[model samples]
Target: MLQRIQTVYMILSILVMGALYMWFPVVEDAAKNVVIDKSEPLVLGLILAPVVLTLISIFNFKKRQHQFVLNRLSIILNFVLLGVFVYRSLKVSGETLVSEKGIGVLLPIISIVFLVLANKAIKRDEDLVKSVDRLR
Candidate 1:
């Protein structure tokens, strides 16, 4: 069912976000030795907070309105995170003249896409329930 899919997406997103947080210290240490700026870890945290919050919001899906609000907030936060990453990438690209590929880029993109799909599924579910109620 769509609800199950949404649940799975949320769980996966949560796991990914948590893993990044857990590994951040090690990553920061590694980055420090490199020529790149050390502020990447803070930027990563800013990008991840909404993802973690969105996963927490999934538990409240039984309350349709709340779920909708949470999903909207998640979407907004994801956009903000995306913007930050893009800006940072551009800034670094200008300075270094070479772009670095990292796990951070892919994870946020995947999480955002999944969150968007899950939000659509939630809306469809809500409409279906409303239609059924009208038929009663």
Candidate 2:
């Protein structure tokens, strides 16, 4: 099942998440080069949760409905991450707090795209299974 296309999509999602952790800057400031690393415990957890969920979904291929639910959950998590980025970009409390949006902010969007593709594939498989069941 790991050889499936959805698995590849999940792996790519994981890699993009890792790249965000390793080299990307989530937030920048006017004077500072980079403001926030993915290393913050909460940030790190949020960054990795989708990867974990996607992996779980990949391995649970025998349960297509469960896998579909997991993918939807992962998509919701990505949307939360995107919301956080947008929030950080909008409101500032102090001179040092001004948020400069970085290209790193786009990582969640990329992950979401892959997740959507994976979900689409999962839906196709589910449909095929249903159609086959009707044949017998």
Candidate 3:
């Protein structure tokens, strides 16, 4: 199972997320001041949650159903994280507080795409198993 396509997708998602955390800024001001980043507890937690879930999903690959569930949950969390980024960028005084929205904000979307592909692969595996079981 570790060699499955879903595993590759999950690993790529993890790398994207890690890159986002390590080097990207979510929002920065005109003075190069970071407005939101890993330093913010809430943002940090939100970013980490999906990575943790994906890791769990990778390790639980033997249980396709469980892995699929974990991916779904990770997707939801990523959506929530994206919402937070959007909200921060759209604040009424955003012009003053956040002069630039960083490319990091789009990292979650990339992660989500990878998770969706992983889920699709997992579902295909599940269906194949079910079909084989039906034959026996």
Candidate 4:
């Protein structure tokens, strides 16, 4: 169930990011003073991280060991990404508190929740594995 939720979250995140990129020029024009450069590596990082993590999650779905590591790593990565988002949000929010730019803040929060849930699911799987091992 949690894995499925995570998958859905990743799909949504990717779609949101793609939409932002597609409409970036218009968004920047509306903001007037601020310009969002989608070409930047940082923007690329934000877009690619979730994609890679999602693929990893899907590939390791049946492989317990890999799923454990991938889920844990995803949680850590989500936290790191959250930090980045918060920092950027703070910097941008300082200029304009109620702007389209503020929408970026929601992405990290959603991603973090999904990643944490994935980690919990992975931990549950690990416990089940240990219990089965003990049965032997």
lDDT of 1 by residue, 1-84 (tens): 335677677766667656545543322223343332324665666656766677667778687667767767776766666576
Off by over 4 Å in 4: 1-35, 92-98
Please provide, for model 2 over 54-128, each residue's C-alpha lDDT reduced to its tens digit, 9 standing for 90 to 100: 889888989988988998998898888877766755553344333334556788899889989988988898899
For candidate 1, give the lDDT of residue 49.
Answer: 70
**Top TM-score prediction, candidate number:** 3
RMSD score of candidate 3 (Å): 2.4
Q: Which candidate do you rate higher for TM-score, 1 or 2? A: 2
Model 1 ranges off by over 4 Å: 1-3, 22-45, 93-102
Q: Which runs of model 3 end up more than 4 angstroms from their true locations?
A: 30-34, 92-100
Ten-residue segment with the worst summed lDDT in candidate 3? 91-100
* lDDT tens digits, residue span 1-136, model 4: 3445545554564465455456543223325544445466776576567657666776666775676566566556556655665565555533552356555546655655655665666677678889999999
Q: Which portions of model 2 show Cα errors greater than 4 Å?
A: 26-35, 92-101
* CA lDDT scores, all candidates in order: 0.62, 0.78, 0.84, 0.58
> Model 3 over residues 1-136: C-alpha lDDT tens digits?
6689999999999998898788765466555556566779888898899999999999997899999999999999989888888786665353544444556678999999999999999999999999999999
Q: What is the TM-score of each candidate against the true structure?
A: 0.70, 0.84, 0.88, 0.66
Better of 3 and 4 by lDDT: 3
Query: What is the TM-score (0 to 1) of candidate 3?
Result: 0.88
